[model samples]
Target: MEGVSFPPLSRFAVCCGTHGNEMTGVYMYRHLQKQKVENITVTTILSNPRAVDACKRYIDIDLNRCFTNALLCTAITDSSPYELRRAQEIDAEVGPKGSDEAVDLLCDLHNTTSNMGLCVMYNSSDCVAMHIFKHLKSKITSVPVRAICSDEPISEGYALDSVGKHGLSLEVGPQPNGVVRADNFNVITEAFNHIIEWLQQFNSGATFEGGVEDVYKMTEKVDYPRDLNTNEITAAVHPQLQDNDFKLLRTGDPIFLSFDGETLRHKGRELYPFFVNECAYYEKKVAFILGEKVTVAFPSISVTKN
Candidate 1:
């Protein structure tokens, strides 16, 4: 079958299963399909078939990373025997030839390995993006959820980026075993329902604000500091790193005072250890931090406060 369409209305595309191990959305998609939602026509497309089978991030290439125009053309050509068939099936369901009626909305399901609460990854623009997200957050705040900036560096090559080029990315946090998973699933699914209901309610006079601008230009992905390899500490734990403390590392902070591993130093006068990926045991020690602003390895060295 090419596709199973409801009546003729705005398409609310719900894409799930982009990452293999983040299987919460896959189950939620199944649950959503079994139900009877009214108004907006919903189409749930399952990406990353190989990843889902292997239960790995991606098989050959990260499907999320391979959405560039050049790569999309190449991938459609290089499909394997099994993949070729599966690709065809998915195409039938949601290929380029699908409806072009100004697709009003898009939502993707995702889970994180880090137990970092729920958040929606959205393009800085899209007026309704924040509206719906805030609404969902208010409901889940008893559960307590936050919104991750789509322009933030962490969320790069995300399915949200692709769809947000057309729709929006709805990342529903990590699953706290089955209980939190159920709650997340219900809440997010209900959020989707509300989107449709809102669309129908405001169909007559829905006004979309222009893309988000002014503060900082939104980016496709966040830039990560590079060459922090070997034994260099970009930022370090002076004494004790708290929950939401921001540490700015200047010259001479005993980045690698002990000096066990090989250290990485910079060219300009300053020469202190830059520690990025240090040990295997330490989960997210120096890699990431939770605060207002984050420093990225980009054109400039330091990052301003958010």
Candidate 2:
């Protein structure tokens, strides 16, 4: 892991508990807000606070998926669904959508039931994001950083981190929903502190020159085996592939297994699998994402490919 000539950050935004039951981020955010740091002002949001209190994933819909432009349009007129309205409110507070002017950066924190480790997920090819990603990877050399850039035409991007400025979502897991593991908490807290200190260093006129060798870029999303008639998931992640996030999946790799003991193997080209069997993804129909490993250099035009 190397460093980048990161720029100074002034105002920052963080959305915690976006999924409600992911308590690691919620607890971490609660811990961070009470402390004071210099050179950067922050706007902290406890997204889906009601859901957090209820110990549920969401009060209505997943806030992470409800922040798109097309959905936000409905959020304005409908105002009925809790998450839809909450998305609008969040946009006004820390997004480019409404009244609350977005700041210099944003970091939406999350946890998963799958073994995602610590991933810095982002959509765009913004240089600032690349710089930050480079810096975070340098801090935690073992953790993987992921880029989920949109390759197809989308009405708007999904996820809260996309709403604000040049930042990303940090997802750490293998912990169940509503449960906070000390190991996960310590890792997230360390990453949070690293971001703070990195920003402080940047503001104090620190410059760096670093580059990335390879990165996993999510190219497609795979759905779990579902019943066509009822549209219900009918299979589970194959035992052979469980907890195999960030691993290579070949054409004949086991992907899922039916309850009745039937196994389904992937018959596609080579790909890297991540977010396998994530609990929150059940509703979204996503079992995992198929990523393409590409040679890339940070802060270069090569990474700007969408």
Candidate 3:
């Protein structure tokens, strides 16, 4: 497929399909490519083609988890035809000298396995990212929740992390065939369109009302696992407490019991609740610990909107 182009702006980009199985964004991006945009131009990138074809997350490597200046150089220098071609495409948009004079924005689309609703993932450290996130939230209030921190630090070298650029990892649902895929698409499309309009205001030399806030700086990302299995293969979950207010349990408090068609037993030590349901049969992305409350965080927004 050919990359979509429009009237040249300072700079803009939309990258998706980092994971082959997570492809809702890919379909949406392809649809967008069929049309013509104005002022803000976009270059579309499909991170892992082999994985997408295999219906898996990756082929040789998790492309999303492999991003570094050295890696890019290696890919370009090692004479890997595919890597060289991919590098050229990427460099055309955000190369060392290409479009560096302008503000470059990347909107990454992704899907989740856990049953969390639609949410946007972004680095709050960047003001441009914050503005895009806030504007998207305002435009698509029904969906399109808060921006999230990436799982990159744990995965080591992530393309988004090493790029030294601003982007949003837009996670939109439970899975590829998740229930809210359509809603997720709408949220991201509306957000993109709204961003276009918001940027247009600046292009016309109009004063924008909202700016990045200090509160945005207060945002932090901490990863917690909803499912944890000991090396010995012991799996235990916290007991179903009186209410969802189960965070009152201390670290050493007694948790719950797992049965294998045997005697019932309670597990000692108060294990925190990343998620009440931690079954391997189900997808468990992450459990976010909020203020005095521990809920699923991977694909869900930190904030709740009425």
Each model's TM-score, in the order given?
Answer: 0.59, 0.87, 0.63
Q: Which window of ten consecutive residues has the lowest lDDT sum in model 1?
A: 296-305
Sorted by TM-score (best first), the order is 2, 3, 1
lDDT of each: 0.45, 0.76, 0.48
Using alpha carbons, what is the TM-score of model 1? 0.59
RMSD of each: 10.8, 4.5, 9.6
Compared with the true structure, what per-residue lDDT tens digits does model 3 show for residues 187-214? 6677677877766654555433433332
lDDT (10s digit) by residue, model 2, range 1-306: 444343356778878988888999789778987879787897889989899999898997778888778877772555487988888898878776422466767889888888878877775455566666677777875556555444322235677777765667888988999899998888888887788887776677666454664567887889988899998888889988899987899999999999888999999999998888888877778999889877666542112111
| Candidate rank order under lDDT | 2, 3, 1
- Candidate 2: where are CA atoms >4 Å away? 1-7, 73-79, 98-100, 141-155, 227-232, 300-306
Runs off by more than 4 Å, candidate 1 = 1-9, 79-102, 151-161, 164-166, 176-180, 204-286, 289-306
Q: Which 10 residues in a row give candidate 3 its minimum summed lDDT?
A: 297-306
Query: Which of candidates 2 and 3 reaches a greater TM-score?
Result: 2
Best by lDDT: 2
Looking at candidate 1, what is the lDDT of residue 297?
Answer: 19
